[model samples]
Target: MSSNKTNALSRRAFLRNSSLAGGGMIIGFNLLNSCKPKVVAEPTIDLASLDYNDFNAFIKIAENGAVTIFSPNPEIGQGVKTSMPMIIAEELDVAWKDVYVEQGILDTENYTRQVAGGSQSIRHGWDALRETGAKAKHMLVSAAAARWGVDPSECSVSEGVITNAAGETLGYGDVVNEAALLEVPEKVELKKPRDYKIMGKNAGNVDIDKITTGKPLFGLDYKTDGMVYAAVVRPPSFGHKLVSFDDSEARNMPGVIDVVTIGEKVRSLLAEDPSFSSKISSSDKVVVIAKTTWQAFKAKDAIKATWEEETPMESTEQHNKILTDLLDGSKFNTMRSDGNIKKAFAEADQVLERTYESPFLPHNCMEPMNFYANVTSEKVHLVGPIQTPAWKAGLVAKMLGREEKDILLEMTRMGGGFGRRLYGDFVIEAAEISQTINKPVKVVYTREDDMEDGIYRMAIKYRIKAGIKDGKVTAYHLKEAAVNDNMYGLIPNFFPAGAIENYQVDVASYKSNITTGAWRAPYTNFLAFAEQSFFDELAEMMEVDKIQLRLDLLDKVKPEDDERIQYSPDRMKEVIKMAVEKSGWGTKPSNVYQGFVNYYCHNTHVAEVADVEIENGSPVVKKITCVVDCGIVVNPLGAMNQIEGGVIDGVGHSMFGELAFEDGKPTANNFDRYRLIRMKEAPVVETYLMENEYSPTGLGEPTLPPAGGAVANALKAATGNRLYVQPFTKTPELLKVPEKEIIG
Candidate 1:
């Protein structure tokens, strides 16, 4: 399939020239640009003829009054498919029941900020989407006013109907034909928060019915005519390359098509281009293409492949030792510093120090990594789950020596992303296989292949130190060390970096062959665990409630004149107080011990409190209370679901999730080896949203950052023994308490 060919027309030009098919209006708005938010052009429409060829246009109103909003971002179960459309429908004055959502293909010329990572889907698209809807509404109102010879101001829209002061009304469909001919307004006024009829309301996801009915909506469910399947035999470890392969037996096997080996030439090209290489796994692998997925997998298993392992690989134990050594002796680079930390620590009344470690985590997305691609000398066609389609398109264009416009990239509903799909290695692999084989091919990564291929959450270690005097933290120091990349990339402005007076943040890095990429909240995933856990210890040291201690610190932050600090002290306190009140902070049942933590990230404020108890010698999470202030919350139902899912994910990872390695190969290849929190272990999650009129922020990641910390603090409160290591089950002393008490 080739990309839709059209004139080099701007969005305004397209809108002005567009014609409705069945008597309705189609509005196209200029999407956000790469450099800054700028209005590109004015929209226009024509009623003389019916033409529906432009793919850049987003909103469509049918003659039957059915509204279809094309969602511009990938939906990785974060509800962008619904929440984004809700924004447009609210501004367009349409009922939620009438809106249908469709995933728009990646078109950088028509859409800005198309990526779904960093929890930026709703945050980035909020204004642009609203404008698209508001413009459409304006045109419809203008058309009705002209037809009735009434002032446009006298006609108010409600649920796709225009009502005049005389109580006479016209359905949008009735005037849509004329509306299509009207010139697009230079500017349209958007509705205030109070006037919202669809946004912020608890509207169900548009795709929920299809998802519940087991319809094929995800990329794994996507199929096309004459598409073949392929599986790969990747290097057993990082920095290893395929040296030789015997595919005679595999070639003779049933349904085996071909065994294609990705050689050093392509690998070298990827290595030379860091921009393309960074977004994909650079591991060299041999692929087996066949008629079916099962056949491909079986043939891959049957092939005898040998790899040349050049670089030495380190085990998890060795890596941990390296981290410990770095923490002990490395000369760290200062990421941030304020006041004199040495002087404050020297004069402090008390000093508290602790070290925390978190192991590598795999995304373990339910669908694994899969993609479909058909590449020819002329163009490349790709359809799959991708968070950054435009970026992937650029990479593929560069690799194939073609322009990005020649590549047709589309996004399907993803079963789960959690930041894993942000990297488009699997998509690129599919394209490469299809290009080599000269056929449409779908590349599928089995659960084991997905787990061991290593685009994992980096293992991290943190050292925290604080000086307390007169019931106040006088000085603070945080030193972080991680494998491959620095934590600064994920969290450059970590909390308490500017919240404390005599604060200094030191960072160090150790290089490794293991591939690491963003996992959910990235550094905040572990930073929150370590930082909040340290805060809990600090609260105990000061003999104060955890919630109050955080509030006090937030209050202490003096407003900086610089724009670098993105957090507001007032906003932080709001969520903390809300969480405390909603969770009954100090008033839980006698058997329950509650742990509270508040954090700000991804432009969202979240405070979480986990209530736990020691039952049968293990920490039992009874319940969790979450308070989130993610701006206006475009869709309440979707927001709640995201928070709940994030909390459960955090809890699962903290309690029993880890990806260990031996000789640079992942030990946990599948669910059996990598433990995930089961349904029985999940806690009762109660979520509350703070009321606000501010623009929407992110909801996907902020809630998860504090989950691990809250649970860790709760475990400490329950057992009176602090667990500094992640996968709390790894701490033997904490687990031995139950058995020891039983034996005694």
Candidate 2:
């Protein structure tokens, strides 16, 4: 079991008489013991009584001038919880401090595309959010103008205060009631980029107070009266079957409420259901319910079950060998082929080929997998941290033979998602357990359970061969082999696709029983390192500058033909130049080893420079300078946090993150075996955002793919050894070392 000081419900030693949100409430959290929420009484805004006029779906204004903005996307520490609302508040011309942001539930009529994956929260919602806020502001201004009998355009608004040419001022709260009666304009003129005051400015994270003060915000901290705790035990191995289980000892344990086997229950419910994701394969599982969390866990440990292996007990050794064979063989599908690869390669001056390997990785979310479900015959209320609430609501309804309308899902702030909660199998387990026992159940997975039975990043191998002739690139061929599934999505149109005339991508995959899905930046995470490192090698082989070589290659792509390619060469060039100028690229100190990487992914262009030095025979990254062109940044502080987090996460994972499997089971189950980058190991990162009039793109995952590649390239410059494999510590010499002495 994990004990998060902020997220763990079991560790809550004291109760807080906080405020409650929605209806006549103040729109916040109530972390009290009672089933009824506690509210805070304020001076300016009455906590007991307040009348709010609903201007629209996204905005609500109180009589005392407090505005509530509903955040529609899941906040997975991706800054969407804060930035998404900033957009709405900006067009509404409200002060950032006066706004109270509330997490909206799954309402399909008011929201579409509520999932948090793909780093598309801000990108996809840009138009709708601006329109929503702009439309509301238009209505409010029209109301003020109608009272004065003046033209709406003549009345300018600032900081939620409208002032006419005659010097008459009216606060938004004064005319909110009249504004609610006016017809909302379908299309209101959005504020010009030059006039935006909220965007391109530093705004603090909205949940910073709750997070730093150890308040109840995450899914793990949610609790209510009459709620029972549950501990579940899944199959020990992948593709295993539950033959029988002995739960007599568990049912007799202290505080044990009930023991239910899920073999026939879940399978029969989802056997014919197409909505079932079937990723977790939880049908062959068992559940233990009890009065307390510790008691439930104790009883769960006492239970034992018999399992039959229905599939091969796969191993990492076998997977590596299979991937190698597949890469060498010819059974592959051509995803993208631009020019004649054979002719260019046959006429090249030199041919180089090297294979890069990566291991499976687990999400290892800090809070672990948990959910609260009250599955009654009439209504099913689910509260938890999930990225795809709408999609999972449908699946849960189908599994319980209920309608989607009967299921209500409330999203809590997630400790970390990184595409793990995108699959809500744990959420479904809570619903299943609650339906069986006819009680409100909150299921919590132990650290070992979360690590062992994890949906891992697919172990993949890539063989990239490039043909060079006369100091110019002639052909490029990339062959990939992965476990379970091949590459899908827009990776085919990524950078160098249009730059390289003779480009071909071939891929082959082997189906494995182990669950594998998106991890961080998905396929681009490791691919960035592999390809960027290869390009550095090519630059060295051709006696060309590393940064100059990329610019030269992009010179072949026209900046105007932006629609033909997924990434713009102009944007890529801008970030590269900015990184070079800011990092003092060519003018570094003689002792500093610098490596440069430029990448385009997630619809954003980013560049990174890693400064490294060998200390005690180990590579110590001193600092990293990052340049990003995600267009107009909504919140600079939040964007910086996202970039720094992504960089550190990328560097840490690349240096010492990997999951090994033996006999179809994880070899490492907890912190005792798994290695994570620590604070002392993290390097200082400086971020610079590209200023532009274009709308904001994604900063969550786009900046991650290049961090490791830059670090790896820097290590190559210092150690003269190119680290091809992930968890670079796998190298015998890259072991633990003492900290370097700091000169004050």
Candidate 3:
């Protein structure tokens, strides 16, 4: 929950007082802030006399029968711009062709859950948006009923037209002015899933044309008349602070305006705010302002700065040693325990143990980190790519000592977020530089700056032991170690947590200077690989098929006893079976080995199957099949795209993603060292969505967890070797293969 102060203007007050404009009606809805109490009763205010607030998103009907819908969440290429508005248009009973979509400004008073992380845009906004459209339809129907002197129940709406039994019809635009004057309704009936007209249908992204035509839609493309480009020369390593700088050479560079050194007060503020700690200039830095971005970059490179260095940082090998020691020791905090684990393990016939490890990964977004800000004594104006504008606004308000209303924050299309933009460090960096220079500044980050000075996905180590007897699993234990925290922070109800009879989970932490945060599916991104790969090993030891072992464990949970399990075993099994059947798991073409993996996360179930072949000693993925049960997919095409992207992203990270550190600085500063999956490496992805009536869940992340596990398991089957470490290319055995046999 947010600690920010609440707004005085309530949703009921805004809707009640909103008036008609240009003979058109505007309808607004209230999204209850999770931290605040839900508004139950409607407010008592006049509907004919007040001005509409442009900050709140709403549906507007004009005299020409055009319906304009405002989408409140940031457009981060997740298709929320089109999908969210589709929800409103479906319930509004409007034609898709008649609708025009626009992005709404950040306003916490009217919009709740504006952030795009956790894949929550569709999950949380479905009910609120549906009711908003239904309310507008109700008002329009009443207006048509009064005009025809007929009962409101006798009016039927279809495609924005209200019709009566006498065959008389009136367009929503014709009666919108009259509807604007009517009393607001407290409740309106919503359409059922079977009757949906626009939702569940394939609609192209609203900004596709602009994106394809190279129109300026991203924050990097933003430009203003007086805007100046700025770049920073930050500390080369973590655990250090800038002491002094000599910028004489930079000052003489071409197009150089001025080199400003940041003060300690702002540095302290940045350090105190966790949202800004990952920024390159968070501690201390010198900023170069110039006429163009290229000039700023060149000038920034010419600056020489002295820093107060702290203790040298440990290398990745040292960190791995720390994790190994923790696993070897008995000191750990037990998170979950069920049945008698000691008795079960002691009584078992065979006990098996294996350890899996993953490296810290960078976001590596295509656009790099950038933001635009204009700070003045009067007010602060900001525009850039941010996942949580409302939260950023609150932070800015506290930093600037200004009212939240005085600060303006706008969102622009992001090139790629993937949980990276959730932190607004870059946004605040731009604001601080603009405030110091007293000019509108666009702060730009080079690829090296963006990669080295950014928060990464925490490197994790997992050790799992299982006890088996009579070819059936008897007990299970899991221990995790990582920097700052453990894997359980994001995934407490990890797979087999409730499936096994005797289970215990423990965690140990090793603090490091490296900063970490959510990346894609967070913990599950790596946990899935460890857990699923271990399950494959277990099946081999037990002489049982992997899929059947999972099904047998799932069958242990009673259908009537709901309190024991965190996830539905039935739903988990459904996806597993779907993936197996669709991919022909038991039958494959010659020279191709198939691997299967299934897991649940983000309130969604996903199962993936990967087909791999050992082509000249290197594993090459030919195709992948993904089955997802997110419940009531709003847009099939967009959902498929999300799944396909997640699969490729997960596989790419598992195969060639690793960020190493030595002496408190990142080793892989740019793409030359940090390898990503190229176009030739991507596999043919086939996706399937389960048909169900449950409310829609998020699809952005659920498909990612299974990708790594499936690919690793497939590689094992193809090459007769297991990959316990991530970035499979790092395996010593694979490196030993002749260079001629290794595919580039």
Candidate 4:
């Protein structure tokens, strides 16, 4: 028998609500509100079974007058589970406090853009969610109007009660059944931003109760009947392969059920293939099956495995040399180009150059990586916290040699995603183990294992040069040399691309055995640091105001002139001024060294200012002030949380996060070896949201990109030294002159 304890509290909650709800196809839902005080149902839905194809998946109105809203996107601490539904609720014209929010299962047929990445959940779903809620309200009003023998134009809804022009009122619950039977409206008017009630207001996170009460909300807490536990032992180091393994001792250990050897197969399928290499460290992995997690973990330690380095092993020292060589001598791919940069540089009176470097960073999600899978001959069931559920489902089906139709996925609230959960390596691992054993299995990764076997953010070096003519900057060029892969294609269309008349972006890469992938804001995370720092240096060298230089550059670009220009100079400039005025950039105290930068990414524009204070010979980040213009705010509190979290996370990583490889093995396997920003080092983040009428953009990632640059620039202002590498903690010799400016 499996030793995993049942999550009775959560299980009971999930079952109770599942029995009360109806609907599957999500064509529409009867969104009803009653004047007779709202009845909020228990907010739990397993989403494992349903029959009503006529209703929408997002909203359910129980006959007993209970309202429940389903949030389909993965809840990865980005607060989408709470905020997304708020958009629907606002259009549904329902009381926010009386509505229950639940996580919806993967329903690719009904939901579009299901993945939670690039901070795009809201931006992509904003229209659909609004229309969904508005249509629901439209049905309710139509039903009320039919009863009153009046048109819908004569009826308006307010707080769940439908009222006629003559003040004749009817509760939405009175005609909900009639509303469901009505024809779907061709169009429904969405609420204006000025009319929003629940949107701009502060609403608590939907999972805060379960999270704060220690309920089984995360994937680690997931459990089911007759499920076995699994732990994997991957190759000792990257580029190594499994020659052979002895499981005699492992099978004999306590609670050990079986030891499955599939490492050789994994190596054949993924490790040796160049087309799909470095997604995970190219290597082998041994799956240890046991009755319990502890037993599986303990038994796995007893297995002895012989490994061989089949490929060239990578080290940090060698990687640094390779990146430097690529930057110097490699013929780079021109990602973007404008006016001739070569001629502009050749004729310039003065030129300035700088390089910034960042090490591969591990995504340290609080829950680590885990997934549960129950695989049978006919069907495969996957349940866990995954960002890309549909994509993972297809990959798992392909790997298991099963049809996509046989796969089913369910999502649980995640502890943190940070782009790590976007890959389904652990999901496939669970599926593979369960397929071999013909039973349900849950695979869990220890923190050490998660770190060692990681798809890290690529270690990259950026070299930027700007040619200056008499009193004006004439040209600019940027080159990126990364490990495994280069920056994404969209980066070429970013801010400076349009701002500089003679500009170019070139990229080159040297493949490494170490794996790499997206981390939070992707390339913009560190690119902002490099680019913004370079711009700051430009301002200093040109004897111009820092914020003014950006304003001047932004003035040079017009959104209409360039087909590739994604950022608006008008919007970008507004934010720059906002940051300067809001942060009091020009009026800070002498003790506080401030740095400001404006950035656009993930479809959101953000400006940030970092305040660094020298205390006891070391620079202490006092605070970060951010002014964000992502259009209208969905939830003020949630938006602020994202900004604060992003700034803290970005600055923290820039200050200390690093994963270095030594002969194909990472030096830091856990928090003990790796340094992160602690509370003492964290700066107070104050955000000012722009009130606008434009449609909303992304929020989760934009705030993070500008933060590193703001902090790095602030440090330079304080210490009069430029630290070009990540992990700013490596140097402690920054000037100790706290009484006055070191260089300013």
- In Å, residue 37's CA in model 2 sits off its true spot by 41
Write down the RMSD of candidate 2 (Cα, Å).
7.1
Q: What is the C-alpha lDDT profile of model 3 across 270-377, one tens digit per residue?
A: 666754554334567789999999999999999888988764666788888998998889988888888988999999999999999988889999988899999888
lDDT of 2 by residue, 99-155 (tens): 877777776544668889878889888877776677678878998999999999999
TM-score of each: 0.93, 0.91, 0.93, 0.92
lDDT of 1 at 679: 95
Model 4, residue pairs in steric clash: 26-56, 28-56
In model 3, where do residues sit more than 4 Å from their true spots?
1-21, 32-55, 270-282, 487-490, 558-564, 732-744
Write out the backbone clash pairs for model 1.
Answer: 15-44, 16-44, 16-45
Which 10 residues in a row give candidate 3 its minimum summed lDDT? 1-10
Best by lDDT: 3
Q: 55-79 in candidate 4: lDDT tens per residue?
A: 3346666544456677778889988
RMSD of 4: 5.5
lDDT of 1: 0.80
lDDT by candidate, in order shown: 0.80, 0.80, 0.81, 0.80
TM-score of 3: 0.93
Comparing 2 with 3 on lDDT, the higher-scoring candidate is: 3
Poorly placed runs, candidate 2 (over 4 Å): 1-56, 263-265, 268-278, 488-490, 559-564, 733-744
Number of clashes found in candidate 1: 3
RMSD of each: 4.1, 7.1, 4.8, 5.5
